[model samples]
Target: MIKFESENVQKFAEACVDANSIDELLAGFNHLEADATDCKTWGITPAEWMDAIKAATAEKIRIWASENECPELLKAIAIWKNCPLEEVEIGGEGDIAAGNKWLDDDGLITFYRWNAATYGEAK
Candidate 1:
């Protein structure tokens, strides 16, 4: 196990909550690891780090499900829970895409969609 500051751990937790991608979470964790302490008492293993990230993601999903209208967030919850997006319980009569867009007027759906539009699809 590697050691780090308790403050690093707290910052890691906060970053995980806001991380919308695996890359972002790992980047934050790596940055924190650079300043770790020299004793086991403050060190955390990679597995523990991954577990913290998962917990943060789950907590975010729970909060989003309870208080958000964006279907993308709902879909994130559904995917996190391993359930069908259709069964995630959004209060709307429209299809998933429509409901998503209804709430935000621009639900990008996935990273692929964002990249596609941002960079243009290949011919």
Candidate 2:
């Protein structure tokens, strides 16, 4: 998991994860980018900040999946983390079906796909 030394950075990361849309996330990024002092204080470039935010979002999702004991979600997280299939305890076909339903219902399939494509090895 990525850790931010600055509280402001941490808060921004959390807000990004909670954001409902890409536009909202972009707005947050723009706001941060405009604050040169805060950016300098964090001691990271814009690219590094974006990387940190992505890491933080993934970490937050992983934590949520673990807390909820959602195997499908955990599997997705494992894929995003690029862990070997054997390392992730995915349930049977029924679990997979349910997981697919959950992902569709929550409109998270695209989010997972985008996240994995952006940060993990291609399938």
Candidate 3:
């Protein structure tokens, strides 16, 4: 179990309204963890932190889904839930060229193509 400061928990809790489903809720939940772990920032891990975070995520998702009119947030949440962190590139633009090379090496879909797919445009 991990512990989070009340103040930090509040920030993630507040963001729940922006989440539309359980999945979205969890993403926003884990986003907090990622933020905390970011060396450029600060974070707190509450006792039994993981469980508490999951519970918080679930509650927030339920509240947001019921209160907000948009279901897309839920879908976004689903996508976030299944995200492969190992496949994610965490750095900035400075890594673009190398990232591109890695993508080619991996035979993975390019961001351009992904954007096109999102917009229903053929790439």
All models: lDDT?
A: 0.43, 0.47, 0.37
Off by over 4 Å in 3: 1-5, 16-21, 27-42, 46-52, 64-123
Lowest-scoring 10 consecutive residues by lDDT in candidate 3? 90-99
Q: Which candidate has the highest TM-score of all?
A: 2
Q: Please report the TM-score between candidate 1 and the true structure.
A: 0.32
Q: Candidate 3: deviation at residue 10, Å?
A: 1.7
Between candidates 2 and 3, name the one with more favorable TM-score.
2
Residue 107 lDDT, candidate 3, scale 0-100: 22
TM-score of each: 0.32, 0.37, 0.28
Ranking by TM-score: 2, 1, 3
| Candidate 2 whole-model C-alpha lDDT, 0 to 1 | 0.47
What tens digits encode model 2's per-residue C-alpha lDDT throughout 19-77? Answer: 53433443444354534553576665676667555544444444444455454555554
Badly placed stretches (over 4 Å) of model 1 are: 1-42, 70-86, 90-123
Q: What is the Å distance of residue 70 in model 3 from its true position?
A: 17
lDDT of 3 by residue, 45-94 (tens): 54333434454544442333345423343333233334433333322221
